[model samples]
Target: MTMDSPIPLAIVGVGKIARDQHLPSISRTPAFALRAAVSRNAEVDGVQNFTDIEACLAARPDVKAVALCLPPEPRFAAAITALEAGCHVLLEKPPGATLGETDVLADLAREKGVTIFATWHSRFAPAVQPAKAFLADRAIRKVTITWREDVRRWHPGQGWVWEPAGFGVFDPGINALSILTEILPDEALLRAARLEVPENAATPIGVTMTMGIAGGGYEIDADFDWRQEGPQTWEIAAETDGGLMSLTGGGKTMAVDGKVVSDEPEAEYDGIYKRFADLIEAGESDMDMRPLRLVADACLLGRRVAVEPFHE
Candidate 1:
């Protein structure tokens, strides 16, 4: 669609993220117009709302694209419905529950000639690209990621996060992985991982992993926990031949050798929507699965330690 005439877009799952980020970004972006919403328990004002994706697609035939913001477990089916209906699709972080499901969706998108974007919103942080550019030519010696937050503060009553495939701590941990994957010049390969799962929960509440570059020069150590209180930490640092490069504030700020280079307020979702527009305009899909793959690897290779039961 032309810039002057924005593409009619619908959002499936008008939950926390939809209300907090997607709606605001959509309102500001000229590339898309909010046309409809599909949510079983929520609705977007000033837009057509449907309780089911099928009903939304059947009714809002004019909608050219849809953003799936639901939990990973149920996202694949909603994305399939959107792609099958000839609508470009945007998938929220972690893509789908399984890597196989994402591949299937990609194949279907290709068959339907529709753009499908598996987005890692953290990668869109303002300082991320600059960090990537800085690290492109430097020899990375070691990378450290410390991502800790209180799930109760971020997720609140979201019980689905502790279920099977809910990802638990990995849900936020994958954000760090996305930034890591984006900034590293070479592919990062997981070496070992330890997961601390609550005795009563299916997913881990904390994760510690070691990874190395595919070319075998550098190493990465990542620690993710959902037990931090008061001030949260989302920081990544890379020690390189030149100096130490730090990305903090969830990638909104960056520093090199203790000197700040780029520090900006968070507007990652805005960038995400803009990139989605660009991908649709170019008739292409961006379904990077590296971050998700790393999580999958952890699940496959990680040593699970049963910790105390987690209570909200």
Candidate 2:
């Protein structure tokens, strides 16, 4: 493709997130042209569909970029294939099943001179950068996160969420961590954690964590649960020397000192694709592993408490 033309792109995985977020964002972003898709059981109309990534890549050599929307467990191999074929890659949140695998992908991308973006969609939320600006000059004293949502309403019949490496409640909790890592002036390190795992599941359904700022003067406490039956809650509040800044509605709204400062509609995926286009143009990669590292630390240093089994 020419520099003035939109980048030819392919999307792998046509699941709910791909349908809801990625496809729509790509449609609106003029920098990318959807050329193909790869999915075992799903297809997008008006686009060439393949049953596998290799077939898609081989058939569409002109497609210079790919977005992987599959689960983290299976993303590494696809990312490797895309990068090896000299294609820019945009990975969904949490990048891969492990930090090491993401690192390998990053190295391969660098070697191949292609861009690989391990995106945290929450960081692209409208209110996040505003909150980051608000906290940039203040001394944060404490942070509290409450991210509780009903899995049945959001995930529906997705049983892989309870499997090992699926990340359970942390699937949502990492969003908060991503925001924290973006906005905080200092690195946040995990101190201790408690994980409430379902008796029959391999992942935790509930978690409580304590983290300390690397610069030493503040602490963060977070509670995550996947069993809220009614109205869901996704909020993060930080008490700084300036005032209390609150980010609610999953970073769609922000309030400081109990006053609403920023409120806007969700456009995270759009922002993500915009950034990806920019990265491809600049020949750079954006992959922040802090959020995933915190999750790994939580699992490593946490105390597991087996709770009642969860059923769909």
Candidate 3:
């Protein structure tokens, strides 16, 4: 709340997601000044650093907001601490270990009179809005999402992704679901799902889910895998009575009827930061639990199959 200064903000969890996206987004957002980093494994240049969120809050009273990019399990507590300290919060997606926890955090934020922005970054992908517009009121068809990437190349040595709370392939799968829900004409419900869990890992390395669009019997399928070897793919396509609608390149590209409609460089995190700033300024909260709810429902309906042990 320092006049003439950007809103002081602290970031918790300095992982790859933070370093590659959140940090740069914050640096470019004129509404925010990166004031502190709370992470034992990472540090930010010229910013105060702490091993944990409590210490960061204790040291930076001027910081009015916190952006948490930690694993979903720890994020619940970190968000609670920030809310208790009178700080607005921005939460990276899949906000908590369970849908119930996310609901609790939203209630707490309201009770505390603080805003919470539970970010679903993929919803900001440049082509998503265009795709949404294209599908509005003109849908009676099927949707398929294929999201695949090599965990070895992207996650590298990250073993936590295999932990129960890590959410395995859903870590990236949720991104697809986010975009799907953003563009689709109606709410989605998971009808059935199959998870391919590695014997050595607690979570699935791959998943296939069948979802039902509200008000229709359209088939919606999403396949996500962490074992893809080459040419990482992130694409979603729908067949409608009008034509084919597709979003490729993690929603950076949009096409209709096999013709490109929208294509642009992605600034998902930047868009998220801008939205967070706007919500904070307006004294409002923007929370969406749809994407995560679908994931939770998928988990509840999924059949788990044990695969061979995996190793990096």
TM-score of each: 0.98, 0.98, 0.97
The digit string of per-residue lDDT tens for model 1 on 1-312 reads: 345689999999999999999999999999999999999998899999999999998998999999999999999889988999999999998899999999999999999999999999999999999999999999889999999999999999999999998999999999999999999989999999999999989999999999997768988999999999999999999999989999999999999998999988889999999999999888899999999999999999999999999999
Worst 10 residues of 2 by lDDT: 1-10
Q: Rank the candidates by lDDT, best first.
A: 1, 2, 3
Model 3 C-alpha lDDT versus the unseen true structure: 0.90
TM-score of 3: 0.97
lDDT tens digits, residues 1-312, model 2?
235989999999999999999999999999999999999999999999999999999999999999999988988899999999999999998798998998899899999999999999999889999999999999888999999999899898999889987999999999999998999888899999999999999999999999997657988999999999999999999999889999999999999998999998899999999999988888889988999999999999999999999988
Residue-by-residue lDDT tens digits, candidate 3, 104-159: 88999999998899899999999999999888978558999999999998888888
User: Which residue ranges in model 2 land beyond 4 Å of their true spot?
Assistant: none
Which candidate, 2 or 3, has the higher lDDT?
2
Report the lDDT of model 3 for residue 161: 86
Off by over 4 Å in 3: 1-4
RMSD of 2: 1.1
